[model samples]
Target: MKGIDQAMNTLPCQGCKGLCCGPVPITGKEFKKIQKKVKTFPRKIRERLERQPRFFGTCIFYDIEQDQCGIHDVRPEICRAFGYHKELVCFRKPELATKEKISFKESPVGYLSIDFTWKDF
Candidate 1:
């Protein structure tokens, strides 16, 4: 998960920064969402994480060992939000980020060019 900590290079699940590593404050609603995923309530999860405070880390569902999650397919909403910040989308399947845009043209050439070309910097 390169976006896990903004790492330019991708990392293996086991090499990942763990599920709860960094500064990510959680609201009451967010807390409830996390509880639902972890199968625990807010009261029990109020304590700081083993390595860092809860306010400064990723979701508890993130698996540091495999660098993956035991509940990735059914992760909480907050985790979903992490993959999309503003207009930037970090799609894991594609392994890259994509900027959003609206265009009048969808293709060119045969069907219209699906490929995009831009001048180099």
Candidate 2:
């Protein structure tokens, strides 16, 4: 199936580094599907996924050299959902654009926090 990145026509991801390729949460079924295509899951990656079965760190499939998803065709659903969407607030935080880690929290009371962390992944 075509991932959302292709469906949305977000080719090249202009003006933005591959920040979206950071830690992403996915369903157990999705992980199983991904495992079939990806071999040699790192210990750190496996631990993280064990702790939070839904979390996939640094998208093991991302091709840093190409600056795009290596497995774009069967990438996790969470990866597919990300992009220049209206509900995303990360784009506004330009300073954190090139960082290794990006996180956002939104509350019902109109409060938002964007944090960046330097993780090994």
Candidate 3:
């Protein structure tokens, strides 16, 4: 994961907005963690993030203004695997993708944006 983190650091993610961030598959544990994280945010910050506009398929936790994941620290396994695994290659830097594919030990309970929403938290 550290090696993948290093590789992903070389990506030009700042200006790309959340084009690569879409509805993500997350486990029940991840959901609980995210719920905790979101709950920690101040009311103003939480509302601001929730009000931000995103592309049709974008993740709900995507911070459009900051152009990054709102809950990066507790992001799901698939989010961490993204742009590193062959199955989750980054379009901007495809070479950074590893030959291996990602396999989750625990199947996702639901998708972040599609199945769960701000109301769930």
Candidate 4:
């Protein structure tokens, strides 16, 4: 049995399909919305794509082979905004390397404390 530290450390996202980083095969309009919001409007952004309908081909920045993002330094804002802030969404939430040891979950709704009752003495 693995504890949270080990379970969290072996997270499969880097090796598994990176659904979060992909262009998401967005509709033309949705792509436009993302492009508009993420900056680099129309032509400039369009030029980066393999086809007008495809968001820079069927690939994400994450180098699946290496289990990491290839261009993480230049990753988009949306990717950066995937998680929450100043709040814990779940008990197993990833530990933020930046913040103090503040974690949470969505069990008791708005805000809840950890349920330590499950632990055996």
Candidate 5:
């Protein structure tokens, strides 16, 4: 996974404005981690994040101001796998996608923006 993480760091994600960060599925463990991370955010930061307007279906944790994921370090497995797996290729860099598709070891408890919102944190 470290290799995959290193590979993902090479992606041209800085200017992408989280174009690929739409609704994502998360396992219970991932959700717990996210919740804990979100809780640690200052009230102002958390509220600002909760109030931001996102494109329909965009991820709730995507910080539009930063143009990046808010909980990136504790992001779900699917988020980490994005652009590196064959089935989750990045439109901007399809060549970076690998031949193997992502296989989830744990089933998703729910979707990020759909099933759980900022309040859940």
Candidate 6:
């Protein structure tokens, strides 16, 4: 596992607003595993996982009010591996991390790249 992944697993997500939960990607196996676990998967979640290794916006399992994952235990590999290398970014409101610029040396997944631009979203 990469240093970022390891850090994510260990570090506490304090005051997070589920920014990372937006547009998460998962493998087919992971998707199937998730489907089997949830009794009733939300339409958005089903659509996202229907296609293998696709980017889906705003994880259906995320509790907006709580600002946390509803299914933390069964979250996808990509979700599990996501974390901040340094400081956290409030992606929902880019202005929060204005002074901080989050950049990736490479894509988290070999084929997928995270389009994290402050101005964009």
Among these predictions, the greatest lDDT belongs to 5
- RMSD each, Å: 16.7, 11.4, 3.1, 16.0, 3.4, 11.0
Scored by CA lDDT, what does every candidate get?
0.36, 0.45, 0.85, 0.35, 0.86, 0.49
Please state the error at residue 57 of candidate 3 in Å.
2.4
Which residue pairs show backbone clashes in model 2? none
How many clashes would you count in candidate 2? Answer: 0
TM-score for candidate 1: 0.34
Return the TM-score for each candidate structure: 0.34, 0.45, 0.90, 0.31, 0.89, 0.45
lDDT of 2 by residue, 34-112 (tens): 6554445566644443343112345444554554565567676545556433433255343223323334332221100
lDDT over C-alpha atoms for residue 45 of model 2: 45
How many backbone collisions does model 3 have?
Answer: 0
Write model 5 residue lDDT over 1-121, tens digit each, in one string. 9998777657678778777887899999998999889889999999888899887777899998988899989989988888878898888889888659678899999888888887788
Cα error, residue 31 of model 3, in Å, equals: 0.3
Which pairs clash inside model 6? none
Select the stronger candidate by TM-score from 3 and 6: 3
Clashes of each: 10, 0, 0, 1, 0, 0
What is the TM-score ranking, best to worst?
Answer: 3, 5, 2, 6, 1, 4
Q: Rank the candidates by lDDT, best first.
A: 5, 3, 6, 2, 1, 4
The residue pairs that clash in candidate 5, if any, are none
> Residue by residue across 1-121, what tens digits does model 1's lDDT show?
6575666543233444543322333344444444465454243332222233222335444444445653455543434444334332333423433424323222212110011111100
How displaced is residue 67 in candidate 5, in Å? 1.0
- Give the Cα error of residue 63 in candidate 2, in Å: 0.7
**Top model number, TM-score:** 3
Answer with 1 or 5, whichever has the higher lDDT: 5
Candidate 5: Cα lDDT at 28: 95
